[model samples]
Target: MLCVGLDPDQQKFPLSLQGQANAIFTFCRYIVDATADLVCAFKPQIAYFASARAEDQLEKLISYIHRHYPHIPVILDAKRGDIGSTASQYAIEAFERYQADAVTVNPYMGFDSMEPYLSYAGKGVIVLCRTSNPGGSDIQFLPTTDGSGEVMSVYERVAKSAATKWNTNGQMCLVVGATFPEEIAKVREIVGDMPLLIPGIGAQGGDVQATVKAGRNKNLMINSSRAILYASQGEDFAEAARKEALKTRDAINRAR
Candidate 1:
């Protein structure tokens, strides 16, 4: 499934929307309208709204998506991870306050940090595994020995733990980058058919063919952000975004 990332940057918005109070929301609304039919999910990175101090606008944007495109899932990319009470509050913010269908979370603190989110029965809790960013290897690729004395990468351990131990509700997923297709293949092998939120296919230069070949399953959500969202900086911005999204969606399908 194609998951469009609605990460708006004022500096990168179209000229007409640059100085507007609701520029981020307005740009996102048009993009959603243009490509809603082509996507299975919309992921609005919370940092974009938080950076602009427009959390209220973020809420309104999510509400608009729910009202108009209720069938399309909204995955709030907050990557929140914390202790018990704090994690519970974060879960409320992502699932209750914003009313997102799923949320991206960090799992460095172990299963306890993710318990509150997993407890939200119907909602999805996607944990970070092999991230798309370059520096992700710094920690995720470290070697560690499991209880059985078998050595494995940190990301592999996370995949096994999330799939076997933390997936009681069957609402768990992992964020494996498209950039690392080989890692994605390994992760798929470890987790079997669990959904994988694959990022890095667009502006990050991830190979679509490789990602599809390695990560394809019944539940792969391949995402594209700036490459689709900022396809153009003019009046045809939304159309351009749709064109890019269509190409991406088709490319993934062809690869699959």
Candidate 2:
């Protein structure tokens, strides 16, 4: 259930790793090695690496995970949303270049953008349904009609469509924020047992017990980014991260 997010921020890094070369990879490598046994997946938000001009480090980090922790899947949190050739190229970047087991995508661009990723045989394509940000309600909570003239919220429609229509390969999933347990339950009701990539835990103030109670029936990748990554600002950062990851993992299991 635990999916530790590698959202590395140098400003928050321990002094020891702040100015080191390949610091991004080194920071994430420490976290991965420390918590690999405690998590089901690792989600690397590409923006953090890209903003630091460390895409090469991101590549090396993913490769290291695949080589060292073969059982764990890597979910590249790029949230790419494009159509046609552009979407195809993004798919190549995620699956071919990074060799990630799964990738997060923006469904706002509709089915055409998702088709390119779904074209892959075993890779996963996770859609942004109900995000953790408050502004997401501005759009996701709006009422809309499904294909059959059924009235439902936009997020609900996304759940219905992904489960029934877009999941032609059985590899589709949804991104539901853990902050809104009610909406998470609503999505589960709409999608049955489809897996969900849940974020908004830890620093975002989402409760572990409530999140688990809402989505425990299906596979969930409950993520924590800042809280776990910055568990400590000292040389023992990795050890502290492992401890935090263990705490989160145990809490999710207990709730189940």
Candidate 3:
């Protein structure tokens, strides 16, 4: 699926909408109007809105999108990871408070931490495996001896663990960043048919072609955030964003 990420930064808003929550809402509205037909889903990274103290407003925007655009699934990118009780609260906030179709989460805290969210079979839980950040390799690529005495990467182990042990709920998917095509391909093999939510294609300098060829599955949802959302700061920004998204979508389809 073509997933467009709406990770808005207020500082980059158009001059006419500078420093306003309404501006962010208006920008998102225009983008939804522009690219709705081209995308299967819209991902709003919770951290972006939360950082601006617009978490409540963000929820309202998400709710409005759901009510008006029921055809488009909304994925809340929160990367939430905690124990059962706290995770229950998070699940409520994601599935009830905001009424999101899915959410991105960190699996570093283990299975029980993700259980409360995964319990909802109709909803989705995307567990972070290999991130796009440059510093990610410090921990994720660490070497460890496997049953065969062959060295295995930390990310490989994480992908295998999630696909085999934790995917019992069947709501499990993985967040494999686009920056590492080889790692993504490996994860794709381990997960088999499970959906993978891929991010970091645009501003992160990830190779879109390689990412599409490597990480994709029939269930995959490739994402592009800042590259499209912040494509322009003029009146035609929405149209520019739409063009960029369409290019990415068509490119992905071509690669597939």
Candidate 4:
């Protein structure tokens, strides 16, 4: 259930890789090689590469994972959202240019903006439902009535829409933060058996046992980024990442 997130911040890099050429790709590939057998998926946050002007490195890293660890899916955490015309181009960027097995998207724009991505057969499209950030409640927690006159929060509406209406091709999943176990259980109840990408465990201090109990009986990709990535700032970063990932995996299993 543990999904190792590759958010390679150069400032946090080990001494050996700090000034190397192509360090982003090299660092991420090493992490992938070290933890591929320990994780169910790899989530690469796009802003980390884009801010560092290493988009090409991100592409190479994903390609390396595809060529070597093809069994593990790559979820590009772009959270892309746009109009239909522009969303089509963004789809090309994610599915064609990056060749990501799955991509995280913002569902605020509704189904039309996401249709182009869902058009790609066999590719997973994960929508942001209840985000991990504290500010998510500002919008996600607002009460709104559904078509049936039932009151629910925005996140609940998103979960309902993704499960019953928007998931025309069965390629949809929801994002519910690990911080809110009650909300996670509510989402699980709304969307039966659908996969959920649960972020906010390690650096964000979300509990593993509550998350497991809330998200039980469904597919959950519990992601841990900084805690695993910077497990040690030494030459053994990859091994350290693997160890942290293994420890995290064991914790989630024990919770299960």
Better structure of 1 and 3 per TM-score? 1
TM-score of model number 2: 0.98
Residue range 1-256, candidate 4, lDDT tens digits? 9998999999989989989999999999989999999899999999999999999999999999999998999999999999999999999999999999899999999899999999999999999999999999999999998588999999999999999999998999899999999999999999999999999999999999999999984699999999999998899999999899899999999999
Q: Could you give candidate 2's per-residue lDDT for residues 160-232 as a string of tens digits?
A: 8899899998999899999999889999888988999999999988888988888954699999999999999
TM-score order, best first, reads 1, 4, 2, 3
Candidate 1 residues 1-256, lDDT tens each? 8999999988888788878988888999999999999998999999999989999889999999999998999999999999988999999999899999999999899889999998888999999999999999999999999689999999999999998899998999999999999999999999999999999999999998899889855689999999998899887999999999999999988888
Prediction 1 TM-score vs. true? 0.98
Clashing pairs in 4: none
Who is ahead in TM-score, 1 or 2? Answer: 1
- The CA lDDT at 141 in model 1 is 98
Residue 238 of model 2 has an lDDT of: 95
Q: Per-residue lDDT of 1-256 in model 3, one digit per residue for the tens?
A: 6899998888877787786547667778788889989998999888877787777778777977888889888999999999999999999999998899999988888889999998887898888899999988988889988789978788888889898898887788898889899988999889898888888888887877788778654687889999898888786889899999988898888887
